[model samples]
Target: MRLLQVVLAAVFIIFQVLPAATRAFNFERPCYLRGGICLKQGTPDCEPFRGPCRAFTVCCKVKGLWGRAAAEKP
Candidate 1:
């Protein structure tokens, strides 16, 4: 149980610290450049891609889309 608690705590710390690290290094820019979005974990259809998206985030694609769509949202 202690080991599990320690692991959970470490994960929490990584989530907390990663955002600061990203701000310091501008790591999020690269993810944007790659057409990936960083979303909080458990968002639907989130498939992992390489990014600095902290421990609680998942780097996901915009469903095979690039640029704006011709169809308008009604």
Candidate 2:
């Protein structure tokens, strides 16, 4: 129907007009400012950061030096 077409067009326009969420380097929030890395949930031995981060990602503590040197057992 013509009404359905109009509704669909409006919905498409609204989505296109909005800013898309992406993996861009985020420096404005407290997470990036405090050196938080948004790694996927449950990365082995990574400490969880209690700050806002990207969707489906957990802000993790920086595993510098010794932490990175350790090899994963697979």
Candidate 3:
């Protein structure tokens, strides 16, 4: 019984607690729509801009949808 408890506790710490502690949290900034562009609905498009969405700025689309855009290199 004691061995089982130790094994379970070790597994929990190694698989759960350790990963959580060492994981890096990515707080992505919300994308912003550029002005002067009309937004549509249905189907997500992140064209004209490509790749992962930029920090704090959203990908622009004719339709308002979630899509990835290019992240500027530092």
Per-candidate clash tally: 0, 0, 7
> What are the per-residue Cα lDDT tens digits for candidate 1 across 1-74?
99999999999999999999877765342344255666556644544433556666655555445432121111
- In model 2, the Cα lDDT at residue 64 comes to 77
Please give the range of 10 consecutive residues that has the lowest summed lDDT in model 2: 21-30
Q: What are the root-mean-square deviations of the candidates from the true structure over C-alphas?
A: 11.8, 7.9, 9.5
Best by lDDT: 1
In model 2, the runs with Cα more than 4 Å from the true position are 14-33, 38-41, 45-59, 65-74
Query: After superposing candidate 3, which stretches have Cα over 4 Å from the reference?
Result: 25-74
Q: Which predicted model would earn the best TM-score?
A: 1
Pairs with steric clashes in candidate 1: none
Per residue, candidate 3 scores C-alpha lDDT tens digits across 1-74 of: 99999999999878886666544332222345433122221224433332234343343423344444332222
**What C-alpha lDDT values do all the predictions have?**
0.55, 0.51, 0.41
Q: At residue 56, give the lDDT of candidate 2.
A: 55
Q: Pairs clashing in candidate 2?
A: none
